[model samples]
Target: MNCWKTINISRDYGTLRLIMFSSSTVLLSFLFYYLVMSTIVQTTEFTQFGFVTVVLSLFGLVLTHKLLHCLPIWLFGGRAKIKISTRKLLFPLMDIKLREPLSRNVYLLALFSPLVFITTAGAVGSIMWPQFLPYFSILTSINFGLAFYDLVYASHLMKAPKQCYIEDHDEGFHILIKQAV
Candidate 1:
């Protein structure tokens, strides 16, 4: 196999830029989702959870989003190592390292699973329980923010050859293609 390209989005785009993009995504998604849901469900009742509860719930959402990324790979018989650690002694971080490369389609599926699943569930929940729309919208927006990096990685992968394989590395990911004889 030939190494086609190496993509390190954080390095290429800069961590600050990526963080800014993700912050914007969270705010914009929340605004858009809240507006749409509010119109659909004309209820003025908004349930507010406690500050500690909200923080813990958001943390759980982040963990769930990370697990969703691994779900597809697990189903495809791939092995991954998940590391959970704390950043700044407060924020939790989860890193998943793949034991083997995956086909372009499967890798894309893994990258997108969190966004699709969480967003869909949030939408459905908001519609069913309008009073919790704020919470649902916040969770969904946060998921989208977390998925910003995944979306960037997917764009690069999508441009690679369809037969390519994606391998995660400490830097980012390596796109490999089979050599033609």
Candidate 2:
């Protein structure tokens, strides 16, 4: 069967949702960090360089996050081919594509595993040094934004029958439903 009509990433995630969610997440992150989490922050003699390092770690977290996301893909018996591709200009971006089709639960697990693991670590670190709450929250918020696409895809997958196959492609995913013989 032709899988062309199965999943269209562009149509699924259009420009409207992009502008709305991106702006909303940033605004909410600032508000939550200041209004809610600001109380938990403990004063410290954190140096500018220290803050600089913390900020720089966000970039490292991008790689770490991707790695964590791939753990399930590999453990669950899927192909995890890591590749580096350039964006609009010379900016490089790293991606890991899965060649195997994953079950609904497995796909969701891989999609959200990073969020749970990273957020928990951030929480522990925040407790050890509350002064880093702002950075942690901002980075966490950005991670959530990055995972938004997966969340939307998961929602789309929910429409499929219980016994369905989901393959991760460059544009998005192709959901194949298995029929009872």
Candidate 3:
């Protein structure tokens, strides 16, 4: 599959609308962090097993997050795939590709799904295992870090709605926005 595609942004309004739609993810992520982490530091602890668990959970979270973004593309009738660059272990990444163009809203949702899922799950895990809350809190931060790009693209994608993509070619995969019917 081709790793790059140019998104043609033909409308200014669509760009603005996309930006507005994508910014909500950042705002929501912040609100979630505040609501969930307010008292987390004071009440949590870490152990060897907890630390290991947190690391493993983070790996799972990252894979799941990537999968979440791909699901929307599939749901919209496009093919999505992940490819890793073995040469860049220092900055390993996943590349997403899709054939069918989806709506701006669908693309936005795909970007933010990981944040929503990982944060919610981390917060819930903390609550469930109060003694290991610190471990979970650390996992929460890691997941947030993973979502950073999705958040940024969500914003840029909003800005270039007509184009339907916010691609970082050094990375992989670009958002594809379909024309409105």
Please report how far candidate 3 places residue 57 from its true position, in Å: 2.8
RMSD in Å for all candidates: 2.2, 3.4, 8.2
How does each model score on lDDT? 0.88, 0.71, 0.64
Model 1 has a clash total of 0
Candidate 1, 52-131: lDDT as tens digits: 99999998898899899999999999898788878678666789989998899999999999999999999999988999
Position 22, candidate 1: lDDT: 98
Candidate 2 TM-score to native = 0.81
Best by TM-score: 1
Runs with alpha carbons beyond 4 Å of true place in candidate 1: 1-12, 87-89
Candidate order by lDDT, highest to lowest?
A: 1, 2, 3
Please, what are the lDDT tens digits per residue for candidate 2 over residues 7-125? 44342567687768976875776567545655676656442337678767877888888888889888888878778788786666988788777787777788788778876776677
Clash pairs, model 2 backbone = none
lDDT: which candidate is best? Answer: 1
* Each prediction's TM-score versus the true structure: 0.91, 0.81, 0.63
